[model samples]
Target: MPASDPVTSRPPLPAAIIAGTVALIESAGPLEDQSELVRAHGAQATRSAQFMERAWLLGERLGLPDDLSRWRSTIHLVVAALAVLVALSALGMSRAVVGESRSINAIAALVTLLGLHFLTLGLWLLSVLWPGAMSGLSLGRLALWLGARMPGERSPHALTVVRATNRLLQERRLLPWAFGLISHTIWALAFVLILAVLAFGFSFHSYQLSWETTILSSEFFQRFVQIAGWLPSLIGFPVPDPVAVQHAGAQGLTALTGADVQRDWAWWLMGCVFTYGLLPRVGFALLSYLRWSAGVANMGQPDSGDPYVRGIFARLEALDPPLVTDEERRSTHPAHTLPPRGPGIPGTLAVIGFELPPELPWPLQSLPVGIEGTTVLELRLAGAAAERQNAIQALGQIRPWTLLLVCHGASSPDRGTARFLRETSHRVEKSRILLVEAEESNRLSNSASGLRRWSDWLKAEKLDAIELVAFPEVGQENA
Candidate 1:
C-alpha cells in the first residue's frame, strides 16, 4: 500500500465522536490490553487502520455513536424551528408597516425589516475578521445550546462530542464559519419570505407610500433614495426620482395622490430590500457554506505520531511474530560486573543498571548532564536472584533522593523487571528509567515506538509516576 493509503479518512462528525471517545476512555485509566483481539480481527491491517478500528470498537461499546446521533437529530430540529421563526418574523414586519394604514413610513419600514438583520450580519463579519469579538449569544449558538439540552434527557457523550468538534474546527479557524453558515441561511430564508409577502401585498392591495421625518430636508431624502436605489435600478428595479421624493415628503402624513407615484415608491421599497438585504445574505451564506464544506473535507484523522497512539500501535505490533532468526548466538561478557567505587562518598543520586546487555559498558562512562550531584552508587543487577536482592538492599542503605535505573532499549519489559522496579522505587524518594539504545546492527527497538511501549507498560504496572527517559545511542554518545 502507498504511504497515504495506510489510514482511511472518515467523515468529520463520526471521526470526531470516535476520537473523542478514545480520549475519554484513555483519560479514565489504562485500557484493557487488546493485543489478542487485534491479532484476531485486524492482523493484516496497517497500524493506523488497526488503531481507528480499535477506537470505533470501543466507541460502540460505550454507546457514543448512538448518543451523537440523537444530539445531531436535535440540532437539525432546532435549526428548522429557527428558520420558521425568522420567516414569521419577516412576514410580521412586512405586514405591520403596510397592513392597516393607507400610507407607509418608508424609512421606518426599512429599519423594521433590515435593522436586526444588518446588526447581526455586521457582528458575524466582525467575528470572522477578529475571532471572539462577537462572543455574545447568537441564533446559531442558541440553537446548538438548546438542541443539546432539549427533546429528552441529555446523553452522557453529548458534551464530549461538542468539545471534540469545537476543538477540531477551532484548530482550522472554521468554528465561526460553521455557525455563520447557519445564521446566514436563516437570514436568507427570511428575506425570501419577506419578498414573497411584499409581492403578494402589492399585487392585491392598494396603498400609498411616503416618508415622514421632522428634521430632515427633502433634498436629503431625495439623495438617500437615489443612492440607495442605484444598485437595484441597475438590475431593472424602479427607483423614485427627485420629484417623487419631494412630493412624498411634502405630503407628510397624507397619501401621495397619483397612481404612478405610489407604484414607483412601492417597487423602489421592494428593490432596496432585495438589493441590500437579500442579495448580501445570499452571497455570504454561499461563502460560509463553501468554507464549512472545505474544512470538513480536509479534516484530519487522529495523529499516528502522538505518543498515546504510538503506544496502541506498539502493542499491536507486539502481537506479530519475528520474521528473522539468528542461527547462532554467544555471550562473551559476564552477566553482572559491578562498577568500581568512585572517589567521592555516596551522594543523593544512585545509578543502577538493571539487566543491561553484556556487551554494553558498565561503570557508565558518561551520564546525562541535567542530573545534579555526585553519583552515590553504581550497581549492576543481573543473573541470579541474589544479586538483584543485593542491589535492592544497597538502594535502601543509600536512600537517594533520585534513583536512575538504566535498561537496554531492545529488551521487552517482563514481570521480573516490573517487580524489581516496584521494589527499588519504594526505597528511593524518586525513580526514573533510562533506556539506552543498542548499536544499529543489534537494535530491536524503534526509538519512538520503544519509548511508548515502555510508557504503556509503566502505566499498566501502576508505575506511571516513574519518568521514562530515552538515552542517546551508544555510538552517538561516544561520537
Candidate 2:
C-alpha cells in the first residue's frame, strides 16, 4: 500500500498518544511556528483532523515518530526473548519428567507442567478482580518497562510519549487487558511446545507412568485419577479403570509394562494438558485481545476542549483571513448613539487593546479619579496569531465584572475585529468598546470619520448592546 493510505496509518491508540504528546510539548513551550500548517489546513478542517495533522507534522519534525518506532522495536525484542525463555523452560520441564530412571510420577509430572502456569493465572485473575492488587507486574508490563529503560539514543520526548500511552490506556481501563494478552499468549506458546515435546517422547521411548503416595491410601489415588481424567475421557482420551488405578498406586514404577497400560496413561496426561492448560490459555488470550482492541478503537481523539488544544484551534481560526463585504457609505446622521459613561467603572475589569498601533501607551496612564484602586487585567490582541491566541487564552481563565475593549479610532472596523469582540464579550458581566484617537495631527480627521463608521458597523453587526466610547488622548477623562 502507498504510505498515504489510511490502511497504513498508525493504529488509533498510537495516533492518539502521538497527538497527546504534541499537545503536551506545545503546552510546555512553543515549538516550531505552526502558522504555515494552519494556512495549509485552513479553518474548514475539523478540530480532530487538524490536531492529528499538526501532531503528525510536529512529531516528525521533533523525531517523535522515530522515537515511537524505536520503543515498539524494543518491546518486540523483549517479548521475543520472553517467548524463547518460556519455550526453553517448558523443554527442561519435559526432560525432567522423564529423568534418568525413565519413570514419570503421574502426580509430580502434572504439577511440574502446570503448577507455575496455574499460580500466575490465578494471580492475574486476582489483579483483574481487584485493580492494583498485583501492581501490574505482568509479562506485558515487564516488556514495556524494559523497552523504556533500554539503552539507546532516545529523544527527550520519548518518555513523554510512553507516559501519554500509559495514561491513555489506564484511563480507558485497557491496561490490564493489554498485559493479560501478552501473558496469556506466552503461556499458550509454552503449552504448545510442551505438547510437542511430550508427544515425541511418548512415541519413541518407553517410560513407566504411575501414581505413588507415601501418606495417602490407594483409594485416594484412585479417586484423584478418576476425577482428573473425567474431562479428558469425555473427549475420547482413555481413563484408567479402578483396577488399573489401584494397581498403579500399589505397583509404582513396576506396575504397568503392558502396551495398553502405557498407552492409556500417556494419552490421559496429554489430554489433561490440552483440555485444562492449552485450551484455557488460548481462550483467555482471545478474550483479552478482543477487549484490548475495543478499548483502542474507542480511545477516540484528544480533547478539543482542553486549554492547550483550544488555544491551538484559536490560533488556527485567527489565521484564516476574514471575508470582506462591501458596506454602504457612512451617513451624516449617527445610526446608533453612544451611551454615556455610567456612574462608575466596575471594581474588577478586564481591558483588551485590539489591533492598536505600537505608539499607543498600554494600561492608559489616565483614569477617572474615583476608580484608582480597581482591579484590572490589561492585555493586547495584536494581528499576530500567537498574540491573539495568548489574549484569548488569558481571557478564558477569568470572568471579570466588566470587559473594556480598546481599539484604534483611526482604523475602520472590519469583520475580523467585530468577530473577536462578539466572541469575547460574553466572558464578563458587561462589555464595552473604547476607541482611542491617535496623537498624530494627520490622523485626527480619519479618527473622527472612523468613529461614525464604527457606530454604523456595530449596529449592522447587531452589537449595539456593547457600549462604545471615544478617548481623545492617552490620559482621557472618560471611564
TM-score of 2: 0.62
Candidate 1 local lDDT, 1-479, one digit each (tens): 22332134446557555765667657768654342234223423466555666676566645677777887898889888878888888889888876977668887787888899889888888888987766565455566677777868565677776666556666678878888888888888888888888888888888777788878888999999999889999999988889878878887424556677778888888998999899999899899999988877664355777788777777767655444445354344233222222222335888888888887777666665455666788888775788987887687666676888888887889877876776666567778888775563233245787888899998866678898764455677699
| Candidate 2 C-alpha lDDT tens digits along 46-155 | 55565566677667656777888899898888888888998899889978876566678887898899899999899888767876777656655666778988998887
Question: What's the count of clashing pairs in each model shown?
Answer: 0, 0
Collision pairs in model 2: none
TM-score of each: 0.62, 0.62
Candidate 1: residue 34 lDDT (0-100): 42
Candidate 1: where are CA atoms >4 Å away?
A: 1-10, 28-30, 33-48, 151-155, 252-256, 304-479
- Residue pairs with backbone atoms closer than 3 Å in model 1 (clashes): none
Which regions of candidate 2 deviate over 4 angstroms? 1-10, 26-33, 36-44, 304-479
